[model samples]
Target: MIILLIWVAVLIAVLVLYLRQIYSRFSRYGVKHFKPVPLLGNMTRILLRINHFADDIFSLYRSFPEEKFVGRFEFLNEIVLLRDIELVKRVCVKDFEYFLDHRSVFSTSDSFFSRNLFSLKGQEWKDMRSTLSPAFTSSKMRLMVPFMVEVGDQMMSSLQKKIKESKSGYIDIDCKDLTTRYANDVIASCAFGLKVDSHNDVDNEFYAMGKLSSTFNFRQVLIFFIISNAPKVAQFLKLDFLSETSKKFFRKLVLETMENRELKNIIRPDMIHLLMEAKKGKLTHEDIKPNDGAAGFATVEESAVGQKEINRVWTEDDLIAQAVLFFIAGFETVSSAMSFLLYELALSPDVQEKLAQEIKETDVKNGGKFDFNSIQNMPYLDMVVSELLRLWPPGIGLDRICTKDYNLGRPNDKAEKDFIIRKGTGVMIPAIAFHRDPEFYPNPDKFDPERFSEENKHNIPMFAYMPFGIGPRNCIGSRFALCEMKVMAYQILLRLQVSPCEKTTIPAKLDRETFNIRLQGGHWLRFRARD
Candidate 1:
């Protein structure tokens, strides 16, 4: 008993000393920051499930009003959160090579998750980016629009069926689920070259595989933290972040699909077909598809780097990894974005009315049929989608790993010297927090689309709004994603009027325990037929 007690005391003392050594880093460097707890670091509230992640970040970001950047720790790992617009611009764009890759979240040996374009590092990443960029060009997006519109029509039909079956005149929906199903079909048709009706075939294997892959439970979360904090340790132990079931399922699907296509010489306007063309060096950037009006605020332009040719042979697993990443991103992320946008439309009736008016006008102007050009050209639709991204970005906070030692100038005027950030350190950009700052957007909490309006959009500070990220390594799929989002909003509003229901929270507060951005009670909204 005495020996056991002694060992416990010694272990606690050692832990205390270790924490002090790490926590003192920011102070020693003269950087401003909040005091972090021992194990949870600055994320105690979030890790402990006491406070919502968004609100916690809101408090931390606002707490340091005068700071250019603040130091933070995610359990012993150092993070510098940039607050200044110029610093953000430098890290994300000007000095892009210095911070070239996203920090590792899983062991690199995990081919499915780690081999995807998002996980590839250095020159490998650059090559893969160049290869994949042609598939996401404006012309490619134009080709995929018909597939998206087809999915939108299916979703509308599904909703109409539900309304007819409802005892009440209106059908109350968990917009999250509705959007998830819609997004599932869109990704299926566009990315995998598979046609699916998720609403009709509720228990489809593809949908099941997507949910299994994307939804992270507590064990997965813990595994992610372990892998993120100590990659070498996780790799040494062969800790797999993704389940073997999901890995095998996605691999077989991709391989079999490729085999069938190759055997039959199938021609389809989808990502799989594009990727096969990419493998043969036939996928090159085409002339930008022209639209009569603005391409919307959330759209990302194709850079010269994206257009440059590259030569690298891809393994079959590499092909599978990209498809699976596409599935996860399209299914989980775009679905959440759709849910949030629907939530906003329900809460703000006037905003909904204006957007509904635009949808109605555009539909009528085009002789009661919508096309890629007609939908993409709506300025008001663009503004609303932009605002939705601002209020609830797909990735609330993201980090970039420094590849070389770089100076971050100074934390503020009072600092004696520029802070030299070492190689391998992560520089976090709290984009959602910056978007919510009152200094940048007055009455920041209000769901106002006018902030992105043609007359007022130039007023937005640079790097303050990056829902699809920024820089050369920014989302290649941003244009594709925006197309998906806009199409759904257009389809739903044309058929139904969204309004808050009994299950909907009045001033929606983000759920504390969720990894994803979700509402407290639920994202519940009533969809009544438009008169």
Candidate 2:
């Protein structure tokens, strides 16, 4: 018994020494960080639910304002939170080759969702990204406008019916639910080539499936945290990020859709059709070339497998993966933005009024028909949406993995010597922190659209207002997302005025349980039909 006790004591001592050695890496690199506790590290608060993930990261980011980068242990892995905009630009764009891959939680072979653009790593990501780029071009976005308009009309009709059913002229509506339905309908039409009435049929299979697939419930959150912090352990355990039910549903849906389209030879100008074209080896280099300003013209290095070999065949699994990505990414992000924008407008009566006036004027200029061109022409609407996104970006933070060893040394900075970031290090860009910083956005809490106005926008530094992120890995469907938001907002604001209701949360309290920046109790507002 005495021998056993001595062995146990020695083991404990070894563990203490090991932890101390691991924790010393941050200090050796001159990186400021929270003192780590065993096992949990700086994530104890978040794991305990004492503070939200976003709140904790935001607090950490704000803590070391003068530091170029702040280090923190995510579980046992030391993650560097980049505070300098210049360094962010370098990591995202200039020195992007060294950080070509996102920190994937699941491997492609493990889950269908993991094969999507967001999770795909290395050359596979680049090839797929290039292949799918043209599907979200300006021309393609314009083609999708009619589909969006149809859904917007449905949404407005549903809102009108709600107003009629209410005893008072104003009807309290859950903006999140309403926008989600609109987003569901739009994504259904554009992605699946099916006109789903999500507004009327609340429990429609497509919408329900979408919600199930995207929801970050308690179990999912825990799994995501584990996978994100300890990817190797997750892989060792053979964990899958996507639920089996979601995978089966989406896989079956894609297969059926593809088979039907091929059988009928029905050509729909949508994402699925474009994906089908790629499958048939009809997609050319011109179709996939980077046209957007956000995607730089820098030539991406050739993969181990040549371009010709990579483009030879696009399989069924690949098609399903891309389709699932569109559904999951499109539905939640667009709906969230729409809900928050409407909620903000409801809170700010003056901004709402001004925006409504602009829409009305633009409608008159276009002979009361608000087409794609007219929607794009509205400067105020653009500014308002930009500001909304700046305040509530879909992603709280962006992460990249160091594929190669990098020396982070600013030129002519003798005081701060070169710091080595070893391969496999996780680099985090705290986008939410940057967006809310008073240094970049004066009076950051105030909802001011003028901040993005053509005259005032230049005053804001580059890389400061990255709602869709920067570089080649930025949100691919940004154009489609913007078009969807503008169409819904325009249609709603044109006919109905969004106002604060009794149920509306005044300060817009965030749902701490959610991974995304979601509002508590939904975004409630009253919609009054314009005479």
Candidate 3:
């Protein structure tokens, strides 16, 4: 017994020394960081669920306002949060090649998640990005406007039905569910070429599966944390972040869709068609079959079909992976944005009225119809959406991984003069923190669209206002997302007045459990039809 105790004591001492060394990493480099606890590092708050990831990051970001960057640990792995907008600009754009990839969670062997554009590193990411860029060009977005508008009309029709059914002349609606249904239908039409009326049929198979795939339960969250913090362990254990069931479902769906399209020679102005063209090594601006009279725009003429020398083709798995990414990403983030926008509008009646007036005036100017050009031309609508995004960015933070050694230099005398960031270090840009910082926007909590107005917007710093991120790695579907939000807002606000009800939370409180920015209770709004 004494011998066993002696061995145990030695083991404990060795571990303590090792962890002390790990926690001292930032101090060695002359960087400031939150004091770390043993194994948990500075993630105790997040791990304990005392605060959401974004909230924790924001608090830390605010804690060290004078520093250009602050170090923290995700377990033993040190992560540096770039607090300086100029440093953020340098990392995201000017010296981007050094930080080309996001810190990878899944191994390359996990094709389902690894092959997607978001996870792909180096050349693979570049190739896929080039191939997919044309699919979201201005002309292609113009082609998609009719489809999006059709969904918007369906949404309004659904709301009308709800109001008619309500005996009180107004219906209390869960804005999250309402926006989610609209987003599901839009993505279903645009990506899968399947028309789904999620507003009418809430239990539609596609939407159900999409919800399943996007949801992160407790077990999944734990697994994700482990994979993100200690990827090597996950790789050694052969763990995949995506469920096998989701993988199979999406793969089957994509295969069937491709086979049917090929068999019938059917073509549609959507993502699947463009992906099909890419598979055939023929994706180009010309290959995009425009909607009736829609004009074509310039696109990079790059073939992404196969590496002929290696005989490795962009397989069906690749197509399905990308399609699934598009569906889930578009579905959840857009719905989240729309829900927040409506909730803010409901709470602030003055802002809502002004935005509605702008929408109505723009419609009148365009002969009572919202077209691609007219929707894009509404300056006030743009400001409101921008402000909403600033308050509630769908992606709370942006991450990048160092691919090569980088010598980061100080912009001014206040910061460290020269710091060497080794390859493989993870860098974080806290969008939530930057957006909410009072220094950037005076009176940050106020829902003021004037902050983003033509004259006032120039006063805001460059990298400080990145809701969709910056540089080549930014959200590829930003334009499509904005179009969807604008069309929905235009349709709903023009026909109905959004007001707070008995159940509406005065200042929306974010749900602590989920990482995605969602309100604690469902967003409840009373909608009354305009005469």
Candidate 4:
């Protein structure tokens, strides 16, 4: 009789807890707006469909246009979604210190590729950024021009093979697949110093790994959330962030590369060589010696005393982590950008003709070569890429964690109460929302490259156009991604004409499993060789 009573009491407690959680999550806002659910919050829509998340938030913004920032909840955690462009600038750039760390799933012991520049924080991130800034300068990128050209030539040759096989006047192919192959090959050469023939070999190892990184299943997304949201629990339970198979393959590949490079004394202009240089404490040609007590015989002491400089204080794991991120970021972002570009070009043939003309003019200026200087000065191409980013960002949105307490600017008349932001709060800057705002961008839905024109660009507010995000923590590989995309487009446009097929969707739907912006259905196009 006593045991039975205890069991009944336990059951009642659980039921009450569950009911309380549900009530708090679905509670509607009386004045400001509706509150998000407890554990699930707005995530149910995200889990159900990617387009739904974008649509739901867009609808919410339309419903509460008066509110400067909307109160939202994700997995029971409260987040503020900034609507006003001025306020967004304050959150993402002007007052960046308030939100320093990016929300990510990582631990100290994760694979080195897992903790690169994208997910690092505080002093460590600052140090890494400062040290690596020199590597991406114009001089360095110029040195890499030949390397890029080699890859481009190889890609063009592969495309010729595909055209030959088609025999038909035009080929019906998925441009997305071809672009992804090209991107994987380029990044592999740059990161691992290995040449991947992904264009020729569909089942190439590098290509397979690249595809696997972003191919998250339904269960995997759930697991990723559990690990990301509550890392402490995951750690206690020894939960894995990456699949065991992926972890093993990447670890082995990185290890093998390090071993071979060290043994052969090989040197390349890629990221791996730069990282190896950091390990050797020979980043540059400068030489220095430690200071000693002043003495009459300064010459003798100077000769005896050695340099006190410590070698670069990063581990091999650090290099691996950085390289992995470069591979993933460089590979995926560029591919997506190309995919969007194709979709737009296919929809608008006039745009394609104009782009091809620009490419030809630029190529002629470089003495019949696609040189660095020539590629960098293509303004119309820049406009096209910018417009593409506006329509389809590589990532869905940028997220930041509050490092210190902050305010959502001064309160307005409607809700005349200051938003007291506490530390540890998550601040979400919706790239899609800002890009689609009709206020900042008139006729936001239209695909017009002229919007990014120099004359009209000033009209758009500062942080309102952040496809690659803003502030000090912006995407480091923007240059590389842009360069590759431009080169690929330049090469392909010179030969083929792009047009939308009967099967093309007006607005491509995004996949929900992965957080980054990607196509749910493949982007297909018909390509005809120009006479």
- Expressed as tens digits, the lDDT of each residue in 295-392 for candidate 1 is 46777665555666888888887888889889898888899999999999988899999999999999989987776797567989999999999989
Using TM-score as the measure, the top candidate is: 1
TM-score for each of the candidates: 0.95, 0.94, 0.92, 0.87
What are the per-residue Cα lDDT tens digits for candidate 2 across 383-424?
Answer: 888889888888788899999999876322332566788899
Task: Please tell me which model should have the higher TM-score, number 1 or number 3.
Answer: 1
Clashing pairs in 1: none
Clashing pairs for model 2 are none
Question: Cα RMSD to native, each candidate?
Answer: 2.2, 3.4, 4.1, 8.5
Assess each prediction's global lDDT (C-alpha) against the native.
0.85, 0.81, 0.81, 0.69
Clashing residue pair totals per candidate (backbone < 3 A): 0, 0, 0, 4
Tens-digit lDDT string for candidate 4 (248-363): 77778777887898899887888777777666665642322223111100011112111223444887677777777777787777887898898898887888788889987887
- Candidate 3: tens digits of C-alpha lDDT, residues 1-531: 999999999999999999998888677666778899889888788777788777798888988767888888988888888999889989988898999898887654755778788888887887787677667766777788888888889889989988988999999988988999999999988888888899888898888888887765556666777888887788887777566787788888888998999999999989899889778767554443323212111011223321112212588878788998898899889999999999999988899999889888888888877768976678888888888988898989999999998987642355545677889999999998998999899999888999878788878787888777777787767778888888899999999999999988777777777767778787898999976
Superior candidate under lDDT, 1 versus 3? 1
**lDDT of model 4, residue 200:** 74
Runs of candidate 4 with Cα error greater than 4 angstroms are: 1-35, 50-52, 237-241, 281-312, 410-412
